[model samples]
Target chain A: MTGDQFPLWAAIAVSVLLVAGSLLMLAGCIGMVRFRSFYQRIHAPTLGTSFGTIFILAGSVVYFTVTQLRPAVHEVLIFVFVSVTTPVTLMLLARAALYRDRIERVQDVPASKDPLDNAEMQTSKKPS
Target chain B: MSRVLPYPLLTLSLLIMWLLLQQSASPGHILLGLAIALLASRAMAALQPEKPRVIRFLPIFRLAGRAVVDIMASNIAVSKLILNPNSDMTKSGFLTVPLELKHRFGLAILSCIVTATPGSAWLEYHPEESEVLIHVLDIENDQEWIDTLKYRYETLLLEIFG
Candidate 1:
């Protein structure tokens, strides 16, 4: 079945929603490029994950459900998976960035305690 | 059960994805999906990644709900800043917050949550020190960001996966 078979009003509504969502995603991509710092740019992808994926998935569900005359909730899984995974990737990237900064001792970053300093306390032998 | 579905969750999700994409509930389609899922799980099993033990699942739902709402709110706020060029809403900077939870799986999940949200991005982490560095879109107050991440996310993640 094609989208044309669906009611014209429904098609228009879905198309509008999809377009708006895509625009949001496009804006996010622009933000990535316009932002100067790596950390600053990291916020761009969330535009894609937060509402970008949701809108696209929503459109898919609406189209499928309307055309087939059956409810389609399974697409919720895509939303679930993407929302969950995007954060994980971002966190790792952030941590990696921080590691690089600390090792280099970049100025302005707050000082952190050395967890390794306590390792000798747990050891059986005394320090030389 | 273990032999048949090396990764039960993965297999089930694969099967669901297959059905959703195919939009078919026929017996033949189900068989095909099962076969694909089985093969996929086998491939995944070969990776030998450390198995994540979920001590509490309910907290995960709460965490997810909180994340969704925050992301949405941040998205709106960031978009407004982007739309207005004249405004001085562009003070972006990195932040470092100390962490207590050390589990790799939990840390990974935390990273994703931070990155997925707008207005802030996880930039780096130090395993030895257990500290996370993040970039905030508009850094009006630094302590606010640190406290939010620690109290809002770290607290719940510790309950769920720790």
Candidate 2:
């Protein structure tokens, strides 16, 4: 317990990590704006969710552990949960978009042609 | 019974989350967190989301273990490709694999599993067509990717969550 206060070195390290995380998050947001298509733009948030959150959580783990002298790694839960959930949302959104596209016969995405594929797919769709 | 706590499982998670975040077990903290959890459940009741029923528990653990290992390996692979641009990295592409599981919870789990793995990302799924569109970091063998998804993830998810 280094006096149970945030040491100057820990403060500097945490600040640097926070700034880097924020910058990565900003770059991801920029990627969302710059990308041309929805599919392309979907790649942007991975930067924030994957490496960005990892850095922030690592900083939290370090700051708390160093200051408190007892391990406080539970904040890693936030990082893990967010990383897991973001992809799920993106997947569902993409699926919804694809569903709409197929219904409208959109030309952007390639459509499958096999009848067996169609039958296989039909077995999974239950009317909601 | 009120629809608010239709699932006590979520309530347990909320309590655990509160404790973890606070990193404390003081009586005052526990009381305050319990209040918050109750209020949050009330709010959730308003949404009226369909409650997911998890059937098997053991397979869920196995799936998580697999996901952890795969994500770590994929992270190394993707990092290598990013570090060395001309290391003969295969140009990324998409594959549409037909699926058998229809339950929303199972599908959601599948999405998380696919996207969290660094070298691949879940791009889309067509519910009407029952096919999932995934973008691979390296796209050399489309069949291999499809096979991996079907066997590695879809199989276990169907068994556990479906």
Candidate 3:
């Protein structure tokens, strides 16, 4: 809120981070539309979620830390949470997509293999 | 110590997180954070997920630095692909790579690393076959991606976890 009080170096850093973060998110959106297939499109949003969120939140952390004259590191909670949760959600979505593709008899995706049988076969083969 | 806190590191981190969120180091807040952290660790102990033993701290730092660099590089690369007028020049496809790292904790970290990188996404992992299916936005060469994963992240993860 107090732009005048914000130091020049912190201001430049925050601005750079904000610009870079927004650009990454923009690229992600562009990829989501540009990619041909569902699988290809899925990789797009991670750009925004991973480093995009990181940069924006990091800028916030720096800005707040400078302005507040305290650590103000709570922004890290969002960073940690986003970094952890994004992969989980993406993995689940990917699995669901794979399942749907299998049901529909999609051509590109490999056929679903039973996880238990696969494990057993591996273990049995290792003994030889 | 074990009885009081099942996961000392987890409890300590949670306490730090709580204090950060509160933005104060008052005695009351510290006590409350300690209580919550203890309770959360106890709950975690009940779940009993594989406790990842980090034998080396240096590898963790190295991995973190490597990840940051990779993410930054990929972000630029992917941005270029997206912004290019002739995007069709780039090929996007799936590639499955066999993995030697079998530790669940290590695999999870690997998944996060792969998925977090802009151009790659972890599609499916077969625990039994020790293979991971990843979709690459630009699949110029499959072996290169495999080598990058194996050398860049997996080796560091093996060192940290083992």
Candidate 4:
């Protein structure tokens, strides 16, 4: 209604992006609650982290770019940081969980092996 | 170039990231970013991580495109599985797949791709055994997941990194 209102097409695109992002994030949280085990729970939040965050950030980028009348790409930093850091934290946490499961002898975890010898055996088995 | 910047790509990306963060490309910011990038690359040199070699560039883009499509499809699949009340949880399980790709950087990228996709989490990777264990949500067929990784991702990664 106002003079400052977003253009119709831009508004539609932004709305769709934001809605899809929120839905993905909501689904991710639901997955966390619905899953049965720690391992399973780990996969849940990735939904939010991967495409969810990307969609939301993209929406922000589109909205700001239109409003500012310039290329507003700074939101990409959040995208890059989130995409990189989430995996690192998740990987570390997964490794820690693996270590704990091995130490505690928790059920269903693959057994740990000698790092050095295992590498050698794999290399030796290479067909080349 | 090597003497001044051990990792030219790292330095360039760091400088670009600094400029992007500050949202400026003025001379002062450029100078500061260059200095920071130089210092950071020097610091990185001390750690001495193995240098990643990208043999073919086109496959990287192809892989990225495939990943985006796959992630989008899997996101829908996973959301449906999670939302369904009657879906069985017992079907989800951990799987170990042997890998032939040996480059450390390639392996790292593969893990990121796997984890970033919804419904799959990279659990444990044994470099010596050339195997990685992943926790998959709603894994109806183990061979399907194995083929997805080995053929879809690993082959491209080997082409790029080897």
lDDT per prediction?
A: 0.78, 0.72, 0.85, 0.86
- Candidate 3 Cα outliers beyond 4 Å, as residue runs: A3-5, A69-71, A115-128
lDDT of 3 at A68: 83
Across residues A1-128, which tens digit of lDDT does each residue of candidate 3 receive? 77587788989999999998988899899888888788888888988988789889888888888888567576778888998898889888988887667655667787656766445544443221
| lDDT per residue as tens, model 1, A89-111 | 77767656654555555666544
Q: Per-prediction DockQ scores?
A: 0.39, 0.21, 0.57, 0.57
Q: After superposition, how far is residue A98 of candidate 4 from its true place, in Å?
A: 1.7
**TM-scores of all candidate predictions against the true structure:** 0.77, 0.69, 0.89, 0.91
TM-score of chain B of 3: 0.95
For B44-118, candidate 3 gives per-residue lDDT tens digits of 999987777887889998999998898889888888888988767348888889999988889888998888888
Total clashes, candidate 4?
Answer: 2
- Flag clash pairs in model 2: A95-B125
Among all windows of 10 consecutive residues in model 1 chain B, the one with the lowest summed lDDT is B81-90
Query: What TM-score does chain A of model 1 get?
Result: 0.79
lDDT of 2 by residue, B16-130 (tens): 7887888788998888888888888887877889988778889888888888777656655554544453555336666778999888998888887778666567865667888
Cand. 3 TM to true fold = 0.89
Off by over 4 Å in 2: A1-48, A51-74, A92-108, A111-128, B1-4, B87-90
Please name the candidate that would achieve the greatest lDDT relative to the true structure: 4
Candidate number with the higher lDDT (2 or 3): 3
Model 3 chain A weakest 10-residue run by lDDT: A119-128
| Docking level of model 2 | incorrect
TM-score of chain A of each: 0.79, 0.76, 0.83, 0.82
Q: Which candidate leads in TM-score? A: 4
